[model samples]
Target: MQMNGMNIKPVTVILLVLLLVGFYYYYYYYYYLSQYRFNVPPCPTSCSTSEPKDRVPDVIPTDYVFHLKTPDHLQYSQPSIVKGRTDVVAVTPWLAPIVWEGTFNPVLLDSIYKQKKINIAVTVFAVGKYIMFLKNFLETAEKHFFVSFNVHIYVFTDRPKEVPKVNMAPGRQLTVRSVPSSNRWQEISARRMELIQKLIEEQLRKHSDYIFCLDVDSQFHSRWGTESLGGLVAVIHPGYYLDDRGKFPYERRPESRAYVAHGEGDFYYCGGAFGGLLQEVFLLANTCRSNFEEDAKNGIEAAWQEESHLNRYMWINKPSKVLSPEYLWQDFKPRNPEVKTIRFSGVIKNYAAIRPNV
Candidate 1:
């Protein structure tokens, strides 16, 4: 009601007071006292009172490794037959199932993960010229990679403004994170471990059930379904998977943080793409980042930088699922008969020009 030159109403004043009281009650109950709501439940068993460590551990624990033991019923259809046994398919000594096409049915595999209602997070760092590959990479990924499931593509880029727009499908999303660019490809590559370490600790661990670290310079060409899922998974490098262990270019310097003996190599896993459960991925990122930092401190870089450290870590702590080269094929190589499906292929690039300080 206006008192200067208009009529004042008692009913209007009462209504205004009632509305203010209602808003006050709503804010107090919903915002201030929300924790005591009847629908709120207690924290899960895994919740801990101790604060999370702010820094990476000096020594990574290797006394006990996380292993994925498949039940007898869930074993591969064709078991590795030894010495004339008909129903045997060779598996790694560590029980890390080697995945290839025709070894497992995609339908059933997707169904299992669907039942868990898991959300998968894929992280790819696009820097410098690599940013040009995002259009095709993201579009193809939307069509092929875990098409029926919930997937979040986390694209870390130096030029966030230049990130191209791609139409995302239902139950899928893209997040562009701004990261500082580097002149050297080695620095850009090695920094992934550190960035991912922080991302997992600060953000990803709370949202995604599983996490996949991927190379942006690759494209998905076939179905990269839930068959690749496990507690911890690593893909064999297409270039060195067949190479003899003795000749594998593992870090040989004892002073380097990523040192591995000449003859002590499993399948040379690629650094292009790897994934696992959120917690396990966090451990991997943490370990790799810490190792990379230590190597930097000694003024020594591993032979292949982050990849070298990844190989060393996976060797000491075996991957639960070792994907065949089908998971990561290179366009430079001729398609092999054994590679039933090339889920993702790395495109050729002018490395000397793209990489600084070459």
Candidate 2:
């Protein structure tokens, strides 16, 4: 093409054509092509630096996914050839294989996971009189809680000096963090999630592989060990495990995000004791903390506070394992025969006196 009687060079026209082509290819390869076809790895220091080996699926299904792994050569419902227990059953489907005493071989599991030196982060808060329960809790934990696996009991309390110095066994430790004292038990319970989220992000995530958020006013009585480890674990609340799912005390307020309609819960998990992989526990704690904050801002606290939020999250996320009521028995209730072991029990408390402005 000619402009103002000036002859345009064929080389100039070719160069312009080449520049346009270059721009088109660059845009396609860098922006459009990579997003549609490539799995771009994160750069160092941004987050996860590892490159993905497989192409990520385009669409992830919304339905719950459960993965169960049993010990060698034992049928799901059949009698255990090694232990000769005929009552073994696969409860909770893929969410969590119910961990009973006869269902697992402690020695065999220890030999396998011990090499990993699994660092368990057990977090609990003792505000007010709840501090008194720490001694028995720590002593019993040393005796039964992941005895073979490396364990660190992180006690969050207003009085660090009050935290008992229970003799720790090999591969065990106790850490006390000073938290603000609270008059109300409900306030203390709700704040535990926020404190845990902060700890996991600042410290626990770096040092611990697994994290357990447990109520401080409880003591271990039997083996609570490696068999409970999973991507995420939730314990069945002893009071409501056998009750109809319709009766679960999930948040009933429609405006709250924690609301769960009747007949929706898989299990009524005790907010007092729950845990999982460090990352997953971090997510659970952070999410529950945020949910609690939102509820507070709206001037409507859920009946059970963080516990309500937990049930909502578990319904959507579906924990990898669902621990039976045996994991959290109460001293007040008669021991059910079905509960082969009472690994931990809630100590009797003066709820009226301990609670503030009740």
Candidate 3:
């Protein structure tokens, strides 16, 4: 321990050993440990923050993790189990609320979430000539969709250059993430779950409280605020909410991952719009994406692409909130008396004209 020194005490050697150990740790922390902890690969110049550029290896397993939290000072009507919407079923068999016009108090719910500074992420796809719908989709959104709240719209399209610029509200933003153009609209629909799963794992879990995956071909006609937020949310397919489950357009093929046996599905949920707590939608997107790919490998495409898979998944994992057909009425359909308001509805499209392939 003394080396060439004339006199070296045991304490001196011990102190020197301690100092060496400290230096070793300092070097490891600066050169290796810290890098491992904090360094992320430099993002390619081709893909910036607005675009989803990376896939996470350690994607958190989506599990049940949601509990409603409404802060104090939320003044609303007292609940009466018997006084709710009696015309249309207001609650699911499992007790999840069917969101009709009168079932939720928008003012009180918005105030509760506003106080918490909730951020809602909306994902919409407008590829090919579908981009034309982006204009009214966003403009109407500013007017009726989560107004006065922090709304971030993520529009995925192959044609980023053509993304329309509707003036955003103070707390709202529009992001364009380039996606490949698909010849088949069904392929595009299936790919949505893949991209959505990636988006949630890459960013939404940290930055967003909730997410709404909507159809770009649709427009907002009435308020779509906090009343629709929940752990797992599904809007009833306007076409089939009144129809029996036996007639639902679910994938009946046993070979397909989306197969729903007769009399099993609770409701046929529209693929056009469904969302919830970031984690909940993450589960839906991840599961649907996996199932869709599995089915593709076996040469079995569901009847309605992702929509069929969504109904299958929702059947097994019931939605916590079921929005009535009012949430997504088709403009082509005659308005039902039960649809108090068309919060969002799909505009009739000339599919042959806009789609890449008819």
What's model 1's TM-score? Answer: 0.76
Candidate number that wins on lDDT, 1 or 2: 1
Question: Model 2: how far is 294 from its true place, Å?
Answer: 0.9
Q: In model 2, which residue pairs have backbone atoms overlapping below 3 Å?
A: 95-320, 96-321
TM-score of every model versus the real structure: 0.76, 0.77, 0.80
Off by over 4 Å in 1: 1-90
lDDT of 2 by residue, 1-358 (tens): 6979998999999999999999999998776655332222322342111211223211111121122333466434444555544564545655357776677777666655765556888998888777888888888888888986788888888888777777888878888889898766778888988898788767774577788888878989898988888767999899997779888999888777688877676878899999987666766776787777877888878889889988887877678877777788998889887777799999888877766657
Candidate 2 accuracy as lDDT:
0.76
lDDT rank, highest first? 3, 1, 2
For all the candidates, what are their Cα RMSDs to the real structure?
A: 13.2, 9.2, 8.7
Question: Model 1: per-residue lDDT, tens digit, 254-358?
Answer: 788688877687878899899987666766777787778877987999999989988887886688898888888998889887776688999887777666667
lDDT of 3 by residue, 176-223 (tens): 899999888889989999999989877786678789999999999989
Model 2 off-target regions past 4 Å? 1-89
CA lDDT, every model vs. true structure? 0.77, 0.76, 0.83
